[model samples]
Target: MRHRAGIVTDEMLTIPKWRFAVIGMLEALGVVTGMYSAAMLPGPAIPILNQTFLLWQLGFSALLLGRRYSWNKIAGCLFVAAGVVTAIASGSESGQMLSGVGLLWPIMMVVSSAFQAGATIIKESVFIDAVAHLKGKLLDIFVVNSFGSAFQAFFVLLFLPVLSNLKGIPFHELPSYIKSGAGCFFNVGASSGCDGSPLLPLLYIVNNIAFNISILNLVKISSAVVSSLAVVLSVPTTIYILSLPLPFLPEGVTLSSYFLFGSVILVLGLILYNVPQHNNIKHNSDSDFM
Candidate 1:
């Protein structure tokens, strides 16, 4: 559509400033906090965080978009949540209790999830409004993402003081932190002798960028709740992948039989959640033909 409309210019690549100021800032905070929390926390806590994200997305979608959920959808979400909890609980490293400082990280993750949900719903709402005004112009996902990511980077810098404090870095040492980060990025200085393959961080950056793009596209096509659900559905796949014996791992991790059972339940729940929407689409198609 953009090509046909000849709207592929630099101006077309920009999201509205107001929307970026609001939604983009929230998304940046969410992305930064979510990544920071995960790095500081343990693997077991991630499932709980994912559940928190799902619930928050549902709530945000409902409030922001006036979206209604059917009994099946609710049940499906609950089942997926339960399945993830069960799988993670069974597979998490033994004896690492979530107490004291551990508990704080999960709470932070939940807060991050809430910010993400809010950003997603707001972006979706903006897309909807833009589509309504489409006279011959295209609604470009890249445009929204470009502006949103720019604002996100700005907010990340703005919150550096708080993040630095959380990391126990003195405010005066902020320059040193940046220099150290740059050194690590280029495999130079003190971080040059790190044992891990340099490809790991490169892969992570690629994955994170792709993930943001996917989330934005998902929000554009559907509601934030559905995007969250799509992520919820990936839990099992992630668990299974982790179970593999990769070179980075000291040993092959074994998953409990319960993980398989939970995986099945998660798939079933996702199918249930989509049943109503699928039927509605099919019904509308039949009516069109009739």
Candidate 2:
């Protein structure tokens, strides 16, 4: 991860604007991947079973830093859980099962999100420490992206057999609705069936560099608090769009009261989770961890 961040930092010297593009792409890829997973899963559960991991990530991050859990952070985790519930509640029991054993998509998203959130925390420490040591943001970015890619590459290669199955394959026919839906999961990479997305990994690299810049710029031009909230506006917009009648999303999929309730909770949780706390942070925070 450190290596990846370092490389990205170097690229900034040649092209600083790439960061914004990268951020937008990364955000789009994650959201698109997630929506695809929801369409593919049984009962079309959004947030699925993997929601547990995010909660765990929140807890793990807290423990990793030896920080006591504040009510806001705890509530934030709960809201993340609630968001998943809302997604599930909005789904149907009679949803379609995925054609192949492609469980890796959701798993990848969860794992990546965990790494991402943790890295965000750790990078801050690195950047601040770099200030005292005269380190640069470009170096820090490269280090994060490089290592993140390197570590995740193992999984990509390990899942080679699965990817081999789809190297030149085509997806089975999709209903016209899904094919045309704005939230459709078409054009999945043919790298592997289980989760062989060279595209995803590459996108991950590009995305880290991008959003990291967006956040930095956003904070630079304004403040961390403002940038953080601005980034979240996409959530409810996604939710609303997903709930609406659309040509691409399956017609049978319906959002329930429970799902809406859960979604609201999730929104709340996320809002709380990101709230900066004076008590939760301590001295000696570093870039190796967040």
Candidate 3:
């Protein structure tokens, strides 16, 4: 259906195939390395250090796209970084400190995040380039997403051996392990001890699909940096949602005092970042008057 609709064809793309392949490879590398490093890192450090991706996105947008950000926008990004770190570090009950884990994993996590940020920027560039090259026609978001995800899946298969080892599953047993996991996921076979089964994982899969689609659509209409910032803003909301008592979860943890303070800072940062550039607005108004 997508092919018939002209969404999957190369004719819609502005960039060459090799360049798109490179972007796909970047996406795959980012996901694989991010998962590997995250598996090694402690729980708290994951969120705290992941805030680096925002800065990386901002930097890449400037360096690669020749986009200049105002000082307030940069500061707003910092506020967001600090707010998330404060809320996550102080609120989590277990392993609240990052002192135990060594520096290697944390460094790897940041690098992996940079890879993802680079992919995001490059994808945004594809959209921007398409406008000029496609006779004002916009590229379909799925063309980017489907290809990127297909590449990622291919890379995952290639990296399965290493990932299985990291996950403590024997390389040979990986297939069986996944089979059993699938059985549990579907609530079939003799897979015991899978209480939640299909519901939880289905919800997770659905939610992830929706989130990625939404974020990719956001990138289609806005700059990559803006989409990244929008994701950063979700940290507080996720925290709040997890804090609430839900049917599926055990007793939900109450929001800490740090959450309130950090949320305020996060909101302030978003506001600061979104403040319009005076020069751009004045130029637009002048054009309108003319």
Candidate 4:
């Protein structure tokens, strides 16, 4: 059926050579997100860190991208900030400040958001050039995501070995570098079910696919700042859901009805703002911002 539909098939299909540059770095991000979600994790701080990231993107867009700020954009940012504040205020697990390993979660979110913003800029700057020289979007996805996968894989590999070795190695038995490295690596690497589990690689692949695709389309349809805003709008939904108190709720986190409702309203507002309009600011600019 696939062949009849003009679809090609190959069991030995492989990602192109150039498609790996970004993967390793992104993998490291997944690792960080995982670590912060662990038991007794400081959950409120994640939203705060995300808020900081948006502010950074806004500043960079103003300085480097020369993004002309408008009243609507300003309002949008404010709304997002408000939402973050709300989430953070209500995201408390024990109604106390984030502490211990949980204290680092928000910081990780800042780093993650920074990398995401940078990825957006790089992807945009190179996308058109690649299209004119190489293949279009299809090849673009292949090359770009392959490189991303590779980058993420590199970090995963480097840390995975040491982490895997940590099983029998007593904490006092390890050197300072190994101990510190493991702590930091786990901060990002400790995802849903990581451990020495065989499914860790597969989980990372799934996470990358979900994250990268959401971001790739976002950049294609909007500016980095706008894409960052969209992320702000979208991510809370997923996180909130995962944090919910549904049947069989996980040990680490759970969401309330309030968060879920807030996410819905937030997404609706973003869609209204993002929908293509006749008077789009990008149209007024260099037409490239569109």
Query: By TM-score, who's the top model here?
Result: 3
Single out the weakest 10-residue window by summed lDDT for candidate 1: 281-290
The candidate scoring highest on lDDT is 3
Models ranked on TM-score: 3, 1, 4, 2
Question: How many residue pairs clash in all the candidates, one count each?
Answer: 0, 41, 0, 23
- Model 2: CA > 4 A from native: 1-43, 91-143, 158-237, 245-254, 270-290
**lDDT for each residue of candidate 1 in 211-263, tens digit (9 for 90 to 100):** 87897787776666677777877777887887788767657777888888888
Score candidate 4 by TM-score against the native: 0.58
What overall lDDT, based on C-alpha atoms, would model 2 receive against the true structure? 0.48
Listed in order, each prediction's TM-score against the native is 0.83, 0.47, 0.88, 0.58
lDDT of 2 by residue, 163-216 (tens): 434444233433333444322223343223424244555676788778767765
Runs of candidate 4 with Cα error greater than 4 angstroms are 1-41, 62-66, 91-95, 99-109, 131-139, 156-211, 239-247, 250-290
Off by over 4 Å in 1: 1-15, 31-41, 91-96, 101-104, 136-138, 277-290
lDDT of 3 at 51: 91
Model 3: which ten-residue window has the lowest total lDDT? 281-290
lDDT of 4 by residue, 145-230 (tens): 55566677777666654554644565455575565555444554434543434454556678978887767766655566666776
